[model samples]
Target: MRHDPLFERLWDGTAQMEEWTAAVSHGAITHVADNIITVHTTYFCGSVTAIRTSEGLVLIDTAKPETAKQTLDVIRSWDDSPIHTVIFTHGHIDHTSGITVIDQEADARGLARPRIVAHRNVKRRMERYEASHGYNSIAQSQQFNKPGYIYPIGQRRPDAVYDDTLSLSVGGERIELFHGRGETDDATFVWLPERRVLASGDFVIWVFPNAGNPRKVQRYAADWATALRRMEALAPAVLIPGHGPVVFGEERAAEMLRHGAEALEHLVRETLALLNRGASLDAVLHAVKVPEAYLGKPYLAAKYDDPEFLVRGIYHFYAGWFDGDAAHLKPPRTADLASELAALAGGAEKLAERATHLSEAGNFRLAVQLVEFASAAAPDDRAIQAIRAAVLRKSIENENSLMGKAFLAVYAREAEQRSKG
Candidate 1:
């Protein structure tokens, strides 16, 4: 409470976010009726999406493992009805963790262990958790709200897996699973033929697709584009996205998918062109542009993932690490260089002052860039705390996207803790 800039900035952003944030719409557990009971997940907690058919209930995505009890609480609210089947759209912790809870509940209550469905690659993806969980933590630290974050690791893996495609008949309802390479290598989107509901998973987030989560591992912008196009083709009337409110009607669904698809395609097309032209990584990063044409598209607007992250992701997708120079191969340690930068900027205090000024002037991105160096060099400085708070506040003001808001919130909080001590 000394200053509370980080939380203040985030709070301000949330206040101004009515236009960008998906209308709550009982997203915590909204029931979308279209011969299908689509349970829309909220932002913080896990959501259990289910489709009841004559054959059985086809549940898409279990909840988080730690919150599986809470997820069960939500599910029980809807129906004490047994979970018939589940489709893990990807192997991410948020989507895959709650399977066993649902499974255990179903079993104890004399319900069948829902046919766990997922892409074949999900096994290998899960193995990453088993093999290098520490590595996952480091990588995920950038995007996730660290304090709010809890890993749901020990859960049952999917029993059924498919590569290109899989078709399931639930109580005479046909649900098609298409393998999609997006945010992760093992991703899938479900298409229901009879009900006209598509469980798009993370493939079509209400805001922008998360193709550019700054700290996460490799993300597929092009492949994400491919998947979005595949989803658009189905022309489902209702869309139950992995996060956010359920989108109703074919027209809205088409527009959402189309806008998201075009944005990714635009970024990928331009990024690939820059790479093909022998531009330096820095040059390619700078040269890539989010098309002016698509800027006005509602879903295409920068809200969750920005084009910069996508450009960097695509750069890695093609170039593979080396930035076309030898010096980067043996780059200086981050702290050492940061110390030098702080000194050159006339110490952390001077940089902090400049950052505060820049924040006042509406240059939050640049302000954070400068302060990150100062903060890293002088981690214990109270001046760094004030600057970080200012940067966070400005970031909230300038943030056209959720990615910016989240990144700003995280670092600001970290700086606040440093300030506390």
Candidate 2:
């Protein structure tokens, strides 16, 4: 295999943080170990792993619909083995959407289709998605910053479903699939006992685990941490993560897993402690800080999901939806409150001016709050609309995670359109 400097640095644990991000976005295939080929599919898309076995290739994840064909093509170029089995790390579209392409390819080659495997809850999750198609469509669109992008409701169903643990042997290699609840309820992480290579599907994303996605369903932070520790126990020599660069050494892989688990564990423990004392969600969200030990680690970067967001998800997992604030239990409509505030501040325009001042003073969080009120109060005021758009744009600049940026981008666009009107 040709040598890749970035891949080498990643393997040697010398790659810079920016290089790690670059590796995830760069669609490249690297043979990290014997019988293990990792494909970095595309920017912001899930990865595909192909394990060359004596029988055939055992594939894990097929990437998203857009990059699935390319992912398979790259794998096929390396080896023309028929895919014996395709395992889903979870039911997420990015992981499951490529099965259709794989099936079609098998038919074209006159080969038998691969058996699909996933946790039983994957089917239930798919059913729920189908039932709430409209809502998912909108939510996904907003999440990805793709307007009018309909969520792909029709996904290839799993042929075999396991509840807790499933073991498979193909061509003399032992592959163990353990059900883990992390980014999703039906998450799975694969372990190759023979090679000691762990394929952590979304469970060990290169960035901070997506355990606290604000726009998604409830993420199990405690369970996610446990899963990481479980993977760490295996002392995998190599780690092929769901999205980023591969880890080469046993010590490096174990440390990364341990750090990820520790970060989530810290959040869960601290957040629950505050909640137990009857602290409000707002107080807990601000008070619970990410551990200093995990800071500056390449794998624990908050580029995708922030730690504060994780705290919110932790609150949701243990406590109910109510944030312990009585005012929020059955709060007045936001527009009503915004109108009253605008009137109290003389007018919406005056509030917009104050928001501009706050924004200029580097107080973007408060600036957006004020501008949103102004926009809501005087919807027809072009000045207020412009100010809202500007403030939201500034917030987007200040944000680190894609979730925050995408959501803020949505509101900014709305304000921009309204400002024109």
Candidate 3:
């Protein structure tokens, strides 16, 4: 394997990865090992791993369609081997949408189309995605801060699907696939025993694991921890993660795997302990906090998903959506409730004014809630809309998680538009 100085620094933990984007965004092709190369297109896009076998090239993932051409070009520059196999770690659009480009490339080159493989649930997920395209588009727009992001409806079905575990011998190297419920139920992480490399899908992202995305489906925190433990047991020398730079060296990769698993396990244990004590969801949400020890680790920072959100998800996983509040079990319509609250407070304008005061006092959380009620009570009120927008802007500024910030930003933008009207 050719040695690179940057890779050496990263492998030995000498690199300063305090800035996550700086660590993950290689922005080009990185020669990982003798026959392995990692194509890191962008921070948001998933990284693609190309493994060269005696027979052909095997791609662990294909990035989003927007970066497909560039990703392909990067891969071609490294090794123009006929891609015999393409693996989908999950059915997320960012990881799987680029298959069309690969298919077209194969057709143009007069080579056989790469065989696509994924967990069985990925096929079902793709079907669900097509059915919920419109809703997903709106959710994506809000989550990604894109004004009018449209989720592509159709996704190509995988050529083959496996359940639990599957092993394949490609080019005399044993490649094993294991199913784990992490960021998605359909997640699969590939293990190359010969090279001691683990192609971890979104399971091993650079930031805190996205075990709870408020805008998306459920995530299996416990299962994700178990998967990481399983990977750690393999003792892989190289780890090609789903979205970050390729991790080189066994102990360094093992440390990352262990820390990530422990972080998720801690959250799961603490949240469940609170729930088991018959605590209300509201109580659990506020009480269970991410340990500072975990947050201090650069890899475990709450940049993409908040721990509070994960606690809510855990509550949903074990308990019901009722939050153990009788009033919430059979609540009044939001608009009706907001209107009543406004009336009790003397008017929507009064609520808006109070929201502004709370925001100015550095209580953006409570300020946003009050502003939301004011807006719901008087959706057409310019003063309320302006206040709502202002409060949300402050909330966004105070937010740490990208997902939370984007959602708040979306609401702020809408409120700003309403204020203009």
**Candidate 2 Cα misplacement greater than 4 A, ranges:** 1-4, 7-27
- The total number of steric clashes, by the backbone 3 Å criterion, in model 2 comes to 0
TM-score of each: 0.83, 0.95, 0.95
Q: What range of 10 consecutive residues in model 1 has the weakest lDDT sum? A: 1-10
Model 1, residue 368: displacement in angstroms? 3.0
lDDT for predicted candidate 1 compared with the true structure:
0.73
lDDT tens readout by residue for model 2, 35-116: 7888885536777889898999999998898888888888888889999999999999889998989999999999999999
Residue 112 lDDT (model 3): 94
Tell me the deviation in Å of residue 334 in model 1.
2.7
The collision pairs in model 2 are: none
Residue ranges of candidate 1 with Cα displaced over 4 Å: 1-35, 44-47, 65-81, 135-142, 292-295, 324-327, 341-357, 376-393, 419-421
Per-residue lDDT of 20-125 in model 3, one digit per residue for the tens?
Answer: 4464444577677778888886767888888899889889888998888888888888888899999999999889988899999999999999999999999999
Weakest 10 consecutive residues of candidate 2 by summed lDDT: 17-26
Residue-level lDDT of model 1, residues 236-339, one tens digit each, is: 88787776556677877887788778888888888778788877778877788877666555445576777887888888888898876666889898778889
lDDT of predicted model 3: 0.87
**Count of clashing residue pairs in every prediction:** 3, 0, 0
Q: On a 0 to 1 TM-score scale, where does candidate 1 land against the true structure?
A: 0.83
Cα miss at 43, model 2 (Å)? 4.6
